[model samples]
Target: MKVLFSSWLGEVVDNRGKPPESWSDCPAVTLPDTFGKDRPMSAFIGWGGVVVLNESYDIVETAYKYAQALQASSCAKCFPCRVGTKVMEDTLYKILEGNGSDSDLVQLETLCGSISSNSKCGIGQLGPGPIKDTLDHFKADYQAYISGGKKRPNYHYPYKMTAPCTSACPTGMDIPLYIEQIKEENFAGSMATIREASPMASSLGRACFHPCENNCRRDNVEKSLAICKLKRFAWDYENTHEVDMPLNPNKHTREERIAIIGSGIAGCVTAYNLALMGYRPVIFEKLTRPGGVQLTGIPQYRIPLESLDAEIKFLEGIGVEFVCNVTFGKDETFQTLRQKGYKAIVLATGADLSKGMRTEGEDQGYEGYYGGIGILKKIKYENAEIPKYKTVLTVGAGNTAMDCCRTFARLGSNSYIVYRRTEKELPCDPHEYAESLDEGVKYMFLEAPKRIVAENGKVVGLESVKMELGEPDDSGRRRPVPIEGSDHVIEADCIISAIGQDPDIFYMGDEPKIKLNKWDNPVIDEDTMQVIGVPDVFAAGDCAMGPETLVIASGHGRRAAQSIDQYIRGEEIHLSDEQIMENIIRKIGAYNKNEKVPNPKGWERQPIPICDRDKKLSSFEEVELGYTQEQAMEEAARCMRCYIVGMACVISDSEGGE
Candidate 1:
């Protein structure tokens, strides 16, 4: 990671009257400097976006200045913004301009409320925040503004809506570190940086939804950096071209037995990190093979079985033990696990069940109807239940739906996707959507199932209805509203319902009575991943969250490890305010001169090579060609180094967000 010194290229005179030293002579202003370990006063701290201060500081002046600054800085993309920001600026300026009206103050408040709720994105959503804080803290000054008077000292609030991109990411990865390493052509080093944070780098590179990329600041420049592909490139380069970097040996002789449930990404990740932390990890997988949904639900063509195997092998090498074909509730419950002398149990049995369509004939033995994920598992394991239908209809627009469609493609079944929402509302990755289309999988959007249009308990076709977008639903995509008298029918030999799946806590079977909330989600503390009442049991991944992506589950896994370790040590599951403060690495002072790296602007993103459409459609092999070394290096150069946004996160009330 490059330490940017551009913030202080000029002169620097301290409080001392002596001549200021050059940047080269002074120590770099790093995050740790903000700790006030010795000097903390000047470092500002903000509470709920307000810089905390007492009566000695004037609140009105700072609030007005920032309110005006925020209005000016807004991108003015939406109507609420283009009009609202200008109105806010003019209103504030008038208050400062000494001829402000009472209506002007009221208007400012109204604008703030409307903009916060109605804006398309953060620009309008947060632009009026300072004024809101002003209304709360500095009402006297606003009254004075209306009365044509001046307040001597006004306080300033911290900038709201800063570092939103970093907050949206699940892992909260240091995105810039690996990018900078890649820019320096340290491919192996880049991989090491990624692995330092996440254990499933290669698998994630190929499959992750990459919420980080969605929140990337680089998108404002052009396209977001090819972050996920670059991750894959680093791992691929290491696997084929570079030698493995030896790890510093763990010398501690403490042996703590940690039992992890399931073999999904979360379980694997927990076992991986626990092993690295020098704990003895015993992973229990109910299925014959490991990798959980990653192997069974996800087809091998997208993520080769070997790629996942290599990651599992890496965990094994780190002293993690994998026990396969072992059911948790039946083979061994928490009671049995405790009797085995395990210190803690991590329930990572992710949302592996495929949801059923409660349509007609679904309850009984409906012929040719199966869960999409069930069919995927059947295909992966070469089970007798593999679809033999001539035409298959997969219901859902998520990645799993696409996976099922593609599976049918390779199996020579003409597949059609039945999504109630439009293509714009697709939940699947764009790459998967495009590839599914390329492979001749047809789409029937804006239409959803009414029932299985069956005959004599045999699924022959689907009764459907046309739908139109109404208002945005909870998921933020437009809700699909069914149109009256718009019923339709579609012919298909088989139907796979892929609407969604939730964790199967039913596996618990009333044995130890592991706590579960009304939603059937395991009741785990958000901060600790510990079951609400069960001190010995911790849950992560889909079991905790109904159905999340690989990266989110993996992130939960790491947190689970941290909390379980803390619990084992007889520590609080949640960090105290002081403990969290001591743990943070704050960036302050002048940046280092030597660590500046090359700028990553205007470098066109190198497109990842896809396998020939003909070749991809013909076989159930890996469809995407791995990046060439040259392509990987060029693509790595496109990073905007968004980690600098994390620097703004320095003087917060607690630890980092996300």
Candidate 2:
């Protein structure tokens, strides 16, 4: 029978005149219908958590925070919540006060429609609940306030959209909104908001090179926004807390077929997007299983198959058909696909072939010699043609080399990386390289292979020479210059080259009419993702461009999908990469000049839970285990949403009054 009322500023007062120690266990938190003008207005709370707004907080801010919370809480398995909530929150800001126009309302409604209909989980599917309710219930009130209902204040106007964190995010996520959501303990809602731009919530939460953090407004105060880590936290909570991917209501309408080449992140994401577009995309993969390089090349210590498999299955349930044991060039060609009436083709085959050193001994008589990609493939397939040698030497300092070195160590082989440049010049992500060191992989920097030594036609040692940093190379890194008298030999049983890779474009053939770049990669219209001279042929991923990260390739896949959809529809596409870049510049310019927002505080680095390095090296059962539920939730609580909710209009006091 006891009752309590919680204030808009988070003050809770009870009938006994004070709040309980554990308010959640209290009988009730009720609100009064009316109050004096100077006093805080009691907002009504309908039965069953139906929030009734009556206060003077910014409406856009309210909607944005709620949307962010929903996104963060979202499971990130479907199209609607993963991308829609972000668009909704970002768009709602333009409707606030000064920058707001009538068109914004329409845009918000459309965004809400997609989220409600297509989102994969209830968190995202229902995140728009408060927004829709507010618009419906308070439209007249909003209109009255905007159209000269109350006397306009004489405050000076400044530019809007000034936060760097918002500008840096590719999905235009409302970083400020979700951070506020977490602060309010709307955990599920926060996940929903994050799903809008990034579906790999768990992956990104752990591994995203967070550009947003660098541009955070909080850096001015103390530390930058912990945007990426917080996202990881929310994703961890939902994944560990029994989140499920919702079934598509329109699955019966999926008739149009799409073909996506490759099975890496790009292909997977493309298929996921196409499935959402109501097309059943059959992914053609060269391997027996999906997860191209992500499964085979990437060491299980950093990324586990269980999470990868779970995501793949989620896509499969959404009408995406995956066919393994089929390569595009050999098993089937582009012409064969056109004959099959496939509406679109997305080439997402990642760079699988490793580049070999043009130096001597490349084809030497050795019992155990392999390329980086070949070695990785053997490790993945458990094919023992690659002998379990006693000593191993890996060339190059990129992620590929690190992966091979660590993989060799797990296979009970002593491994060492021989890089021409110093440790500072290593191309591998610092985290991956650090882990390799932990697994007893040795690094011999400033060393380049001179020749492979042989003993009775069997490889005995790798002859190498020490080098010094020279002039900056084309890649802007210091090139290595071999010292004349620094030749040395390291005894090894095998050597794996991991320098780099070029596209396998010969498969496209001479008469196919597709244009190739100087590097022999397919030359495509960057914006349209269309191969030159081949009207219907689209290219994406590493085979199209040179070697790139999984995240960049995923972006290409999505962009190519959009371009392919347009080509299929017979529409003249005008949005080029230049235009997209220009728009980004303009948006950034507009955002950078606005007044700054307040940044939240005290965020520590969210660590990925894992077993001891020694214990992890004994088996291939994933070393850097994913975030636990508690770790992820606490990390998610640290996000400082960096977006501005209201745009300020600059006008003379006399004009503002009217």
Candidate 3:
């Protein structure tokens, strides 16, 4: 990208006096040239150095705005950061007011050094970097402002605060803030902070595949902080103490009723947030209970029933009603819901229809053939009678496959996981894979199912073929290639196909207005979660996006609730400025895995306790015992509070303008 001036991450390219044709491109800095839509970005001042995209940008004003933003974001944790940022902001304002001096320039430089070296967090430590760069590269601009040679540019500066962990989070959770609250022993404050982003605290605390821990800055020093466990601790503390979970003061204040289909994580979170916003939300679930995939697909050993029940009970307390044994498009159509006076409809029916492993005799009426979701639903939800099988083979290598094999193993069957890829390519969580092995679940790697060998239209064995890895597939995983003439049969009385799942949009029932993608998932606005052609209808979770993690689904649910509320209020459905900034920082890459952290090492992550091994294999009891208060506090203290300020200078008429 062409730039007038750039000093990002030690790569400098100055084209102040060069012709446009003779200018050099920025070597390292790569930033968005435009803000929202087509609004040209003048400059970007962030934790990294400055990148001036437009030469007409007023450098002096940009620096002053960045200083002001930095001061506003300061946590006031220490003397150096709080006082130093204030002094910097005051000096810049004085210069902007045409009263600057050479001594003031020198003072600004000194203050930057002090703040960078002594601040308690990244907000102060990295905040002064771009200002220092401006002093070194654009000093004449500051001098011109002070000497009355240049007037104010009045460019709008929009800023946002982010951390490595928060930026990587799908929900944009304030991870550092909540962890800091835990460190202060204020568990309620931490839970409140988490609730700001999501209300599935207990369920997510147990079943969520936490992506925040992977980007934790603490990993540089020791291991990543036990983020997921700490979240569980906060929720467990509130539940065990019998403290009433706080409700939104404006709960049920609004009269418009919203209908949400499916009581999965996405649907539940959407109802929870809408209720908090004073809107009445009714969740329609097909099963006998409210929890959708949590109760149907996930094994009870991972997420306890009581934890999920408590979450639903709290939602009820906030005026969110749950109607069970009601299926969308079956029991109530969109037309029927509208006739019933529902202001908006949310389709959160998760992708629970398990895909079949294309094999011969698979679709035959074999009594033992079952989908991964089907068996889990039968075992966990229906409480149906279990058929005794000598050997149970589950096909696939994802978390569902692990859950399937583990659950069957607990049922006293010789369970086996058959996969086409090696163990290194197993897609399940490492901890889950390890536990499955400990429970005597065997693995058959480099083998793919070819056919289901059945006798008398009943159960039998699974014919397999030897496989090898080929070129990488669309998912970045090597494609499995079957070796010729390598078919073999694995003895099994029952076969569960756990390959994958997709949204069962059969409920849409010939609705042409709601568009769908090639994958049969709904095509909705990514930001607002509003269905494209139908503004009053919204979709989230696996039905909106393809099958994703619980936290991601919850994030979608929160966004959907906001959009639904706006739709009912006759307001524009859009993302907030903070949400826009989050997208920008995410595009710029927040977590630098190779960046050096200055904190001391040796603070090992606390381990979560486990249930008895005997109970783990024989029963569906909870496996992970949540962290105690002492462990939670020690783990929280390991957070480095890596908060940084990001700001953009755009045209006053731009969407990002303040």
- Please name the candidate that would achieve the greatest lDDT relative to the true structure: 3
- Span of 10 residues, lowest total lDDT, candidate 1: 1-10
For each candidate in turn, the TM-score is 0.72, 0.68, 0.96
Candidate 3 per-residue lDDT, tens place, 403-509, comes to 99999999999999999999989999888899999999999999999899999988789999999999999989899999999998898999999999988899775
Clashing residue pairs in candidate 3, if any? none
Global lDDT of each candidate? 0.70, 0.63, 0.88
lDDT of 2 by residue, 1-658 (tens): 1233222113233232344443332222333322211223223221012232223333444454456545555546677777787777666544444455566677777777777666543344445654765565456544544453342333222212223565565444556656656666666787667655445555555545565676765565455556766665565566677665556555526576778888887787677666766777889988888887767777666566666676677668877788999978788777788779887777777777778777577787466667898778777644445567899999998878888898888888998999999888888887778888888999988999988887877778888999999999999999899999998888998888899877655467833687677867788887667887777777887887888766566666667767766776788744643234333333323233222434344566566677876678887776655555566556545543332222222223443121
Candidate 1 similarity to native, TM-score: 0.72
Q: Work out how many backbone clashes candidate 2 has.
A: 30
- Residue 292 error for model 2, in Å? 1.1
Error of model 2, residue 417, in angstroms: 1.6
RMSD of each: 14.1, 15.7, 1.9
Query: Residue-wise lDDT of candidate 1 within 1-658, one digit each (tens)?
Result: 1121212222221222233232233232323433323323122221123332112333344445555555555556578877877777777767775778878878888988997677655456544554576565557667876687674432322332233233454554555668768777888788777876677888888888887676565665666777888888888777776587546265124488989989898998888777777788899998887898878888888788888888888777777789998988888887888888999999899887778767766666678888887788888855555646899999998989999999898889999999999999888999889889988999999997988878887889999999999999888889999999999789988999998987877666544556677767877787678888788888889988788899989888888888887888898777433323323322231112233323445756787788877778878778877778788777766664432211122333343221
lDDT winner between 1 and 3, please give it: 3
Ranking by lDDT: 3, 1, 2
